[model samples]
Target: MGIKESDIKQDAACTPGLSNFFLKDHPDENKWADCVHCGMCLESCPTYELTSQEQHSPRGRVHLIKSVAEGKITVNEQFMDPVFACLDCRACTTACPAGVDVGGLIEEARGQIRQAIPLTGLKGMVSKFFLKGLFPHQNRLNSLGSILRFYQKSGMQKVVRKTKLIKIMPQHLVDMEAIMPEVNKPVRKKYKNQNVIKSKGKTRNEVSFLTGCVMDVMFSDINEATINVLTRNGNDVIIPNKQTCCGALHVHAGDRETGRKLAKQNIEAFNDSDKVIVNAAGCGYALKEYPELFREDPEWHEKAEKFAAKVEDISKYLYDTGYEKPKTELNTRITYHDACHLAHGQGVRQEPRDILLDIPGVEMVHMPNSDRCCGSAGIYNITNPEMASAVLDSKMENVPEDVDMISMGNPGCMLQMAMGVQKHGRNQKIVHTIQLLDWAYQKEDGKEGL
Candidate 1:
């Protein structure tokens, strides 16, 4: 269940002075060289805020990672607990004056940890099934979507709920199920026959879209909305058939080998496109970080860097390239929640807000600490339910009850915030930012009888 002794010896010979991390993708030393133990990041971290423990703080985690490199610690359960407990939200990096890449270090450290102590038993089985077997295959994900569609459409879901059969699972999962969005046909399948969805008017830009594995399956409506907004705004959208999962989830789960494999596939898939647009914050962030996965390989590393340069989040793309403002008005009061990857990770704080404000009659209410993590660091809610719930509860306190909707850029944040809304008995609707813009455009078209 661990790395072989021979493999460890080889890694040691290659990376001399390294004691615990016997892997090619060990945490980058340069990422943490700027850390002065400033304690500035302590206030930004969610775990530190909740636990009030130094070990849970950003500075503490950096120290621990440095300790592992210096032969002061080993990759034991004690070390694993704190590292895995982190939300990997990247808020701390925003707060750090030295700009330490804590999220990158955590991901790389996780890559090392999984090699040293591989998961076994039930956890291992589930991780392998989802991360390896399910995510990378588009056909498999589409099949899962079909199954989910049947479960939700058939009377089985209702019967199970009414019989209290769902209570057999844990409470957090039940909570997630309670607020689960209805599954629809993914946009990839919907537009499969058409290679290029041309613009309504004169073509302004040609961009390829990444219809993500989870994003397409779980929240395909948003994906469809994204295509509509783009086409309506004069961008010819391209959906590359060969594009696979962005590997954010795999990397987050410490499966760096699979992460690199997936990265290579996407880099090749979108090689010809001038712009690669992503609607999901996590997927966009992961796409931009493809270069990190190929640091050791120079040729692929250069390709990854070129690929990463073209990857842009949808909101930023629209804002930067000049999206048309909707003419019609649909009066709705909404507050914006910053998806951790969108706000802190990508520094996309203002672009989405700017997009929201451009829609006529949309009143923007401000949420305090809107950039705080909603505990949906990929599958963190499923893995660490208790902490995720506590973090969600803390996040809900800042949401304005007067708003009609909670708008954000990421699908994971939408689900997590939806659970928060349901749990707290609030009635605010959770929506992607692009959906609002699309709705406004549709309303305008409807009014003009288009």
Candidate 2:
């Protein structure tokens, strides 16, 4: 369902948090005031570049947040329209030399609005039905992913793409319909409860794994490979079943209560573990950020800090472990797309690249502006198709010709990049970094292993 201006504008009494959506959490008196409005982000903003509309630009959105925060305006349906229009791509941040965290500011503002205004119509219906209903519940997401896999496997996707039937559907639906990946596995065969994939030699590290929601559903194999690679290199892998959603989708969407609830759950789950490992960049960024989410809760704030301290990106952990390079080299030409969370969010710029470099027979071509987002930010592609496609197009333009593969750490990015490749009528395989390692180690035909 789409959010109607009428529904948002009704003179409904606003809750404290709901009345002003951009004020409370993560409040930085100076940080909020740092937007100099230099307009430097305008050129780099995907939405602004695509639409050339002031309402869609970063500066415009920031102005809206400021206005809403100062009570200069009531955040009725039309008032929040610009805020909702933001993709949270973080491209604006990348472009902002002042280093204002637009992503965080916009997210907090959205949360405030969600609290104050009751979502109605199409947008509200979808959020309640999907995010609150389907995603948070792992089992349901698994089922939905399975159903989607069938569509991909049964060539329903191909039929839809060929007929362009979804073009008649909602724009968001058409985009989601266009950007599905080739699902290979339904579940990670191992890595379940008490199932430890121990390292071969003396274990150098003991780590807990977050077998993510969408990850467990759609691309379980990658998670499994991550486990195998970790163990083969001599590290004990632990999958803590208690770890729930990293509260990324929830937090990003402005559903803070549920996000905080899940945040507390994940924090307690990882508290006992020495090091918490996450394969998904988005999840990694969120998992390491529990402290900021629960800052207001004096009770859980300390726990949040401790949990945040132990979180590590899977690539960073693997790189630090000195995993030996696979000896057999396939001589494949590949490029890397840095997930925004891993790069800009955590300053994890080198670890993933270093891991890719360590692999044998892999020619790593550094794409121009590799650090820029591919525009698959969680729900951004679904909500903002035109800008997402614009960013994808910009991303694909940087891909070196003759590249056989493009690898990334985030699933959202992989799907978005794959869609970009398809739309351009080109054939380029997209895989996780671990996929390359997994295939390298397999003893099957034409197998390449150290």
Candidate 3:
């Protein structure tokens, strides 16, 4: 918490507003310059695939960043739109022969833009409230969750739905409300003054759980399932009381100042554990990339690197650590939706699918374009609902017919897919990979399976 004023430079030498947002150490010119402008990334890019526009493509976006760095173009809405429009999904990185870090470049550009021209109006207010106002503070996040829990449990949801009051709201808002998971008490409350949840049997490892902001607030059951699965796999899970949100949203939104603040707090919170486990793919991606946030600060950068090395997504960890094959049969057909952050960001494609296939009686169907963005690129779905929904329509269209469930590693994907299911009246359940594993472990017989 010893954040010095000089630690973050207010001004730097570059094209007017350019160098101020991006640190001298980053958006590495060499990285963007490596792009040979081959069109291979076009097919993999969701935005490009949807729009077929050059500006929305990865190579095009890289060109924009390169232009800004060279003083050819100012970082205005023209520049900002292409940069922010990117899913930061790293799909381009996978497709790039030159190995351009498109996601990193986009994030770095966003940092510059946010610092230079801070958002104003309703967007600014909401961004400020969540990025700086709520997520960085654990108490405030939980309080907001508590308020949500009240609305869900106090018959307000029923009243609103029954009275048709929701008709006055935006269609998306009403749709989101309908698919929203019933809020539960935050996982922090379940521990009851305890910091560590000891494994039931011979403990193979000691780890810290980053019960992320939205992961805990809306999908608390997933957090609980993650703990159960971790323990069942022979790990002592430590729920660090001081841990706040992973600040993925902050970083994604280009609020690196706030992201750096949260990174420092989490690095200290989970310092003692052998591993820092995350259930959500987006949080895992952000947590694993924390070192990038301190590119200019070598000392903290080293510490962050060490801290990030231990951050593992639950599916990857379970597959790596090995697990008992489920004896109970789930008896349901399922397809796996690769969360962008998991498949492209973390290079985790097979682990979650492999686990699902291992479960007895679960039919694993290959979902076409399963790795495509579900239109829930953090707040992209909210900020750009039309584009987000179009992407989602593609995702829903490809969802294999008659699949009873769709399993994913990220909570955002779960919510987005849930909304997709509700929109199309598919009646399919969207669940976490860890939740399925937890259910398999807890089931004593065929009578139980979500």
Highest TM-score among the candidates is held by which one?
Answer: 1
Q: How much does candidate 3 score in TM-score?
A: 0.94
Tens digits of per-residue lDDT, candidate 2, 6-97, equal 44443322434233333356233344578889999998776777789887888888777666555456666665677777767677777888
By descending TM-score, how would the candidates be arranged?
1, 3, 2
Alpha-carbon shift of residue 199 in model 1 (angstroms): 0.8
Angstrom error at residue 239, model 2? 0.8
Give the residue spans of candidate 1 off by over 4 A: 1-10, 13-17, 447-450
Give the clash count for each candidate. Answer: 0, 10, 0
Global lDDT scores for all candidate models: 0.91, 0.75, 0.84
Q: What's the TM-score of each model vs. the native?
A: 0.97, 0.87, 0.94
Cα lDDT of model 1 by residue, 23-47, tens digit: 5887888998999998999989999
User: What overall lDDT, based on C-alpha atoms, would model 1 receive against the true structure?
Assistant: 0.91
Which candidate leads the pack in lDDT? 1
In Å, residue 357's CA in model 1 sits off its true spot by 0.9
How well does candidate 1 score on lDDT at residue 249?
96
